[model samples]
Target: MTDSTKYLQALEEFILLGKSAPGAAAVANIQKCISSPNCFVFAELLELPNVQALVNDAEHKKWVEALKLFAYGSYMDYKQQKSAASDSLPDLTDLQLTKLKQLSLITIASTEPHRLTYPSLQSLLDIPTTRLLEDLIISAVYASLLDAKLDTANQRVEVSSTAGRDVAPGDISNMIAALEGWSASCSSVLTEIEAQIASIQASAVAQRKEQLAYEKLVEEKRKTAEKDGSKGKRVMDHSDNTGFGLGEDEMDLDDGPFDDQGGARKSRKGGNKMFSRKR
Candidate 1:
């Protein structure tokens, strides 16, 4: 069910067929494999003993080349060869052509993850119209060759994912380099995430310290205020209990009320008693 093996059963049939096929029969088998709607991966099929034998056969060597084109070459590769030597390679079936273009799309998307503009694909695949290109893209999506959106507004194909095609011997190095670049990008992203988390944690710690320090300052001020209030209360208590803060001109409570003559009231009472006695 994996992308690499999605068409594996169909390919296995070709392998089995090639076992009994001989001479030109092998070339026919290759043709069937390439033209099969379900078959996409061809490295295994190409390596079969019966199929490889076509390379030595003068009459069928071109069929082997045609198969190679399906396995790894793009649609542009076919066009170039057909243009240079019209009969050098076997003519591709419509289905075969469509499949090759789909595989080529995978190659292009892998190299450039974005920027699948309609114009670029049309130029590369020699597709004549927007409708044909869109149909091909939609077919590729349904075939599970790629996961992409048709950005009609943007006039582009936004590829989110793609299946791998058979890697030619020369393509191995490019694949490795791409993997290395991806690993480095992932490492950089991880480092950035770690730095952001550290910054957030450090900020949280600093804020906590500030909050604690502010609370400590408030507690200290409260204790000092209470202590100062206690000292003032003690001073007032001392002034009330021992007359320590009294002024010299302040009256004493022990003296009696004064009379109109500026004599003590006790003297007025005594004069009233004397007058009463005289009466």
Candidate 2:
């Protein structure tokens, strides 16, 4: 069975039993249901016709109001009611008192996770010391009422989570406001994350464009260098051809047969002879 199945089943058992029971017997059923350690909610039992009849009874009407208190009111509320009209309210057993105190932790610690200070809870629950307060908090934790730890150094109860209680009268508006505030905070954080992602993408695109431009410039310079080198080689080849032709003509005259008078001469079979006189 589920964690709350047994508790609700026990409560439902009482409700069904009270339906057929007489007025006084129904009151007894309510008392037993509230006093059970497993049971917490009493709204259904409170609505029974037989149970409601006790409201008119002067002696037993207190049981109806007392069950309402256990269903919605905190332990502090119990104390206040008991103080005001001790004669009219039904007495709570040890289990009922302890359970109410645990349930009261949910109310006091609901607004903020870590807002309940040692003095505040102690005063509300009638706990005399921080040690006793811690024990109560531990008991509530063990019962799955709330997740909390004692902040001994700070003298506070730092609550992390709590079971949701039945929405008492006057709580709907506050709950809605709290939900709206949380939604707004989440939206703000999401926008910041999206902005950061956009910035990173833009930076990457700019870097890629810069890299491509640099590569294009380098390729152009390499092509220009190769063109200039080819043109210089052609000019060198032309100059070498012209100089070679001129050197050959000079060598023919100088290396030709020399006349007896020590003068230079160039002999050709098909053309006239050329001679150079000695200086």
lDDT to native, each model: 0.83, 0.79
Candidate 1 to truth, TM: 0.71
- Per-prediction TM-score to the true structure, in the order listed: 0.71, 0.70
C-alpha displacement of 23 in model 2, angstroms?
1.9
Q: Predict model 1's lDDT versus the native.
A: 0.83
Cα lDDT of model 1 by residue, 1-279, tens digit: 675666887799898988899888898888888888788889888888888888887789889888888888888888999899987888787888888898889888987655489998998998999999999999889889899999899898988889877889997998899899999999999999999999999999999999999999999999999999988874344276656776654545335465455554544223432112221
Which residue pairs come into collision in candidate 2? none
User: What does the lDDT read for residue 253 in candidate 1?
Assistant: 38
**How many residue pairs in model 1 have overlapping backbones?**
0
Looking at candidate 1, the ten consecutive residues that score lowest on lDDT are 270-279
